[model samples]
Target: MGAATFNRRSFLKGALMAGAGVASGAMLSGCAPQSASDAAGSGSDGAAPMTADAYEKLTWSFEVPPEPVDESQITQTIADDFIVIGSGVSGLVAAASILGHGGSCTLFSAGTKAVSRGGSNHAVGTKTQKRLGLDYTPDTVAAHFNNEIARQGYRMDSRKWWKWINQSGEAMDWITDIMDKAGYTTTLELPFKDPNGTFSIPGGAHNFYGPEIQNSANDGEPLLTATLEQYILDNGGSITYNTKAEYLIRENDNTGRVSAVVATNADGDYVKYEGAKGIIMATGDFSGNPDMMAKYCSAFADYVADGAGDYDAEFQFGGLMPGDGQKMGLWVGAAWQNTTPSAPMIGWYGFPAPCSDQNHPGILLNVEGERFINEDTSSVYAGYAVSGQTEKKVFAVWDSDFAYRFDTWEALGNNMDNLGITPVTADEKAAEFEAGVEEKTYVKGETIDEVLQALAEQGGIDVEAAKATIIRYNDDVAAGNDTQYHKCKEYLIPIEKGPFYGQYNQLGPAQFLCVLGGLRTSPDCEVLDEANKPIEGLYNVGSMMGDTFGTFYNFRVPGQNLGMTCITFPYVLGKQLTGN
Candidate 1:
């Protein structure tokens, strides 16, 4: 399973959890001593400090095992050309690439099998994009990246950002070639339209369309992981299941090289695997660890705690990625990234659009029925805007005429695939609206007054205030200019039409697919020490590798996060390590 699979499925269920629960660490034996309290400012009682500022300075230090595993108690030891921790896309891709080049590899996974996988890859200019005639260019994307860093107030390694995007096309081609041979075909996912046009460079967000991996007798379907896993094994590599990489065994000399990894096997026995070349850490983010989240991701963590929404709902169903790789790296003196806490990449979660704009044109309103932002904005801004609202709740109000006004298939039909929502065809939208009339997921009224009355009674909106808002909006539409928000005139479909509708839309504590910000790494995915030198024979990939993003994930480019972490960087690191 890739990272996106679990999130998509859980989001559909609409299970909402209230304020944050006790942040529990993963229970493991033979890894390290279990502390009554984690190091993220928790006391012996396992409770975080009450105040926010105290939580900010908390040390997120890892507790090393008190003593090394006794030689007599050691289980079977394995030797490999390269050791890869974490069987997620990063590790699997690296292992497969290494083995493909005649290098022996061993992949260790914390869970019983691969789980929590995603499907999309963001590429620059590829054969697919060329054929699709998408106008996204490297220069444009570079500019977008530059602007994003400035806007978010986060810094990225410019060299790394340029290097990754420069090679992204080749990386996509390489991975898709392997996937094609393995009976998997890459399909272009839906792209988001900006106010000008499609935000994606023609054929962005490529998803692997293939057979789902078989269900494990234990838990977690291989899904996207199955193909890469099989490729590695077919090439004479091995995957160790139910094994947790407890620590990186660095060389005793002053070279700062991590020579091997020590892991806890399924039998609760310690095992060591020595890597002749290097070790790649692909373990995902630290969202599962409450202490780490509070210490670093405290802003959003506390936001969710104060009834924003369950930010952890996205990870509730999958492997609790407890920042094991991050902890292991930090224990070896790797520098934590000096960036904003890992920001979540959120989707619309079926948030309706209020207006019609080329890119993300929707009529967004606060709970009080007042438009808060220009509806034609990116999902990142939309998510941020809603989160800042008093209630963190919004509504995407439209009318029945919206079906006839826009390309139903393009607008609402592919909405979910474009981000997150049920795929709605024109007929489905009409049908669902009728059903929502009965179910009240949608409020329907024959007249404008009727709709306002329904909205006032059911939606907690003030009838008089709501009427005044709509009247003003309609007046602006008639004047051919939006005075308040300055939304493009084309999207200002007045609410004057009959049969209005609206749905409850929440932006924040909207579950994120994964959090960015982890161990700082170079362009080639080498983990850098505190002195800013590459730690020899050590690399990191996947979400664990950081320094390419800032405060927020770049939602502007769909799949870029997975592209850089899971595909591009792993491939680059693999070739570098293998001397290919």
Candidate 2:
């Protein structure tokens, strides 16, 4: 009675009834429902009372339904040598590699085409590790990963980390080869200067090539996924888009391996595709799964709302990551790894426009109009800028000089124009400044005092306290050292410039792609269960595997994420699968 442990007899009673496929109505009618307080009292007092009706309900039996197979009507579909689930970058690469090596495969996913256009791919800059001419050996890559893991306090599985590192280099080479063979040219070179002054391998790295170059021109995820899809078809692999893997069917005893995948298409008709050899899970992370995100990756809890869809006229949040693999794996006694270190989301550091430019230079400030972290540290710094602020909102305070620098920055020219941000001279920006102006969408404030007042009026901060905070910042800048905030020397420029600008960088929930952390797999890409045992016939590639980013989201090395996908895991998994 202590923990209400279910003995074999009790478990079997319920299991046998459930297995018989009893109707819910019949089962409910036979049971006596108790009040919530009564149930709680039973548990607290260490006694579970089963009424006569409840016992009878537990003893009821129902006939099992027949399998939905009609010999005459059912078409016999031959099993493939391998079946890959989730046709994202990793799935496509695995499928293509398998087919290229004389193995046949069928790729399945929920979306019509893989939604590679998600966060990482959409905003990725075009850069390649090889072009940077950095001295990045495979060992250095491994060390970087080790350092990352150590930094994260070993919260992730070290074994999986080693596996990914061991195979990353070859994976990069293989992806590059595939792109080249497909007529895409690998041309982009690494752009940023490594603050560490040492070359680090790019993440999810790739260079575009040929006729598909323009469409797949940028370092976008969609283009990369599309290219990989084309390669699969070109190499004799079959792809079934708009298909979802509902569950995995194991052997009769659930011991041998994954035998077949039960999938449904757009019409909801189910098909059991047997995989005689292997099954690979390449679905992206569980950021879309609100429960999973909340449980495993809580740092981005505020962003979960953005990931949810409008359900029944109410807004919900969480990863739409069906978590097909996670659910199926659990049912089959498989283990999951890297439940921590979720893929980091990029934070935007800009404020409302005409005072802000999403694509270029902008300054970030906390709710009290204080700059917390280095704004230029990483592309994700914007998202991290407002993290843990008291008011949960930040301010992007900039003037004409900031706007001019943003417009003139070469890397931002194309992006700014695309976003309809025309170049504005310093004088033009100053002339446009408004004092304590609160429009529906944009909040503009001229003087530091006016800005704080507007922010207070708008419910973003306390007006009096915010003014005092700003005055202190101005004093620090005047003294040539930001003793209070420790801001960069360059940014210490006093906000004394007339037409001083400020806008609310709302810290409300928002969704962006980039949820890290997932199933743990070995160097050969074999996914292991929660017990650290291999899930036979199951492998993982892409974001599904963890430890790609060791510790913090280190922007010191660009393209490491893409490099891992485009260059590392695909080939590693391929070699292990094909024994090449």
Candidate 3:
């Protein structure tokens, strides 16, 4: 139904079968052919390759950088001390900081307005936490950061991790001040406590929501972005809407300073925007580009043929960014991150359970009606587990007494640790489940047999196998030791008590979220070349920032993608440029 599973097997097979898969020549159906001359290498108006000899073949994008727009094609030009591309969270913040600090900048957005689809900014030792009395010092976070690194096979992309740890407080405080002036409350998400240490993620997810926040057309990050946009304007910063950045104008080809960016304007004329100080490539991910996805992510290329997300769909759910900045960076001698096959910041969870993250600590069954995971892992891990199964989907089975078994359910969904949060009680949860039954998102039956029937009728699960699984699960609960996945003993609640419920999940738009990474970025937010040198006058932020993540976006740091790439890095860069 989607990008051929995109696991290693399919990626390799597709590459071999397609014989460069839209790289040097014609692609499979729905793909247009390009010449081998498109293969990128060090040349006039081209990227310097990481490899010495690189002309055998390449993917569609790497096949060749589009010819640099001829200077004669340009009809208009704009110059500023600094230029920030792609007006998302990163661009907006970077531009605002520059102008707010009395530096001149021009911000550009391909979209009509600023783009932000996510809320929550993870920070360490921020004013919010200090005021809330939440402990988030280096000592408190060291163990968790170490665990995160261990999970990534001990590969920390750079010391930027430490930078984020040390300076996130001031960066977040900067935004909090803007938010405070707007009369909106910046609330911290109630942290999910893992007594048995299900990859402890304590505190530091700042979200915006309140009466004044609701008054904005866009709440959460949109509100924040809108606020930043206003700040930039108020501080005399300029922004150009409906402008699409095309390529970098490097001096002396790939070996010189990146002096300017050429873009297409609303009236279909070439426009050159140059920055005296620097040009920030904040243009985000390449999820919307099939060739780029197949080439880099090694997934979802064929989805283009299947009529999935297009460029216009970039900011919407199940949509993808075209990775404009990344492509331009590559064309200008920038390197991809060391972590091979860049990971997508996806949310594969089938559903979000109350008082818990998605793919709740309950019985999860593959299509064959067999249990798969420990059922007690974090949401992202649980999502990865679910993705590896048949059809890359599963069904969640639980019972009515599920809430009472645990003293406190995971507050991730409920945001239990929020300062203004009213804890969702066991009775309230049960009542909500009743409401869920009527809504049809959840199916409940008075008895186990009845529930199994409902599961089969609604979800098409094998009823007998489901019953056997439930019985076996109950037996494990009674024994006080899980013989299968070794789920926490205390969390091994039995399924005997009714009414039983089943939440069916099949991979859909909600299952796959945005992809992360493209250009290899330095800790200073500068886009780096293959030779490990920073490309002069070139910087990256937001989804364009790479090398700091591996495998997946584990919420171990909660909204780290935003906190680091989009917020802290750009924010810090802004001050650095202004000598603040």
Best by TM-score: 3
Badly placed stretches (over 4 Å) of model 3 are: 1-11, 14-56, 212-218, 299-316, 348-359, 406-422, 457-459
Can you give the lDDT of residue 534 in candidate 2?
85
Q: Candidate 3 residues 447-470, lDDT tens each?
A: 877877776776677878877888
TM-scores of all candidate predictions against the true structure: 0.80, 0.73, 0.88
Better of 2 and 3 by TM-score: 3
Model 2 spans with C-alpha error above 4 angstroms: 1-78, 118-134, 139-147, 158-166, 181-183, 194-219, 298-302, 305-320, 338-364, 368-382, 404-445, 457-459, 546-559, 565-567
Q: Residue 476 CA error for candidate 3 (Å)?
A: 1.7
Model 1 C-alpha lDDT versus the unseen true structure: 0.63
Candidate of highest lDDT: 3
User: For residues 348-392, could you state the per-residue lDDT of candidate 2 as single tens digits?
Assistant: 534433222121123455666555654434434455555677656
lDDT of 1 by residue, 15-105 (tens): 1111222222211233423232332345344344333332232233343433556668767788887899887777888888888766788
The model with the greater lDDT, 1 or 3, is: 3
In model 3, the clashing pairs are 38-63, 38-64, 39-63, 190-417
What lDDT score goes with residue 342 in model 1? Answer: 65
